[model samples]
Target: MARAGSVAPRQRASAAPESGQRPGRRLLPRSRILLVLALVAALGAAGFGAWALYGSQWLRIEKVSVAWESGSRRELTADQVLSEAAVPLGAPMASLDKDAIEDRLLAALPRLKSVRVVRAWPHGVGLKVTEREPSAQVPAPGGFAEVDEEGVRFAEIAEPLPSVPLLEPDMADAPSVRRFDEERTLREAVAVAAALPEPLAERTSVIRIASYDAITLELSDDRTVRWGSPEDSSAKAGALTILMKAAPDARHFDVSVPSAPAASGG
Candidate 1:
């Protein structure tokens, strides 16, 4: 209520800051949020690395066991094989070469027909081996040799071979020795052995394999069996069984031809 140009003293405002408004709030920019996220990610990675290096149990292979049906159990130990194989104990399971291990085992033990490796989780390995059993003994240059049905020579017998039937060749041209390089003759012998009758097969001492056309047998009694061809060998074997039963004292029985069999009496 003074002059028209005069100012009011009560209208002058105070100089204090506003309530709930921080002065340094503007310094926290978007880059600070990104920095915090990166720090959290680095800590998580470090924790995962620690677990993989020291805490995880999946990195170790604890046990190794082996089992076989034939041969000495102490001959093929899983620990020895695995040690020779050079596989790491704490290595990852996915990095193992199972097939390579099997091949190595086969190379180490030639008597095994097949070998299988099983990997158990967290820390175990199992090995199973299948061994070839000798079924027949054939006359060789040195002495009697043990062979499987495939005619593969495995061991040599000094004397008094097992009482199994001997297989002899009817013709001189037939191969008596089993060559390790050739598999054809061995496979054929296995086929022939499978075809022989159980009773006659048990008595057979040697199996003489010639060309596919001329197959023959030599009995344990120092007699000859003229087996003409491999075809219908089972039938021929059956016929031989009947003839041998009928004339047990016969010296030689020719069952090569089932339709017309010839026999020689003692």
Candidate 2:
């Protein structure tokens, strides 16, 4: 011990980094936790944006294309009819009502026999229409009513075709003309026309369905074809061809029974 001012040699301080770093070790875990939270938040935000853009009602029918079958291939543009039909643009594709649209279209175009509606994904609707085909014309009280293959009376025409056959009563005791049976008589008439020989068919101008069992055909040459039933029509037609060739000058020929060879008038 010296006098009042005494100085002990200072011990050499340790210069190597501290063997253990508590603050840095603690900070590493806290930084990792913050990084994980940030990543999770970013992923959640991305998912939400995707849902709003792709899964919303912004991707709906923007146009329609109407197509017709038979005759002219007229296509009605979407822009012309969509507004009048009241179809909402950008509406959900799942909410589209096809039946309602079909009804509206049919009402607008009465000439259409049937209509089909389809959805072309994303921005379009498709409509396919079938129009009525006029097969025959019959005289009505006011005018001539047009009939289809089904014999359904549709519309009236102002003018009459002179070449068409005039349906008349066969005998004085014949029953009055009844309502045309659309399904049976009309369909049978179409079948008969289709089955007639080209030469005989073109010459035929009038078809009279007297009853379910009796069908009489009046040809352009003022001859008569007594067809008893719709059965064996093709065979009867073939027989007529053979008979007509044999007796060209004959005023009338009856080939009703194709199986039995018979002839009248030379």
**Clashes in model 1: which pairs?**
165-203, 165-204, 165-205, 166-204, 166-205, 166-206, 167-205, 167-206, 167-207, 168-218
Residue-level lDDT of model 1, residues 109-163, one tens digit each, is 5555677887876577777777655555556787766666666666566783554
Cand. 1 TM to true fold: 0.57
Each candidate's clash count: 10, 0
lDDT of 2: 0.65
Q: Model 1, 244: alpha-carbon shift in Å?
A: 3.3
Against the true structure, what is each candidate's TM-score?
Answer: 0.57, 0.56
**Model 2, 27-140: lDDT tens per residue?**
588899999999999999998666644566565678877676557323344454454456666776667888898888677654557778888886788777776655556667
List clashing residue pairs in candidate 2. none
In model 1, the Cα lDDT at residue 250 comes to: 88
lDDT of each: 0.66, 0.65
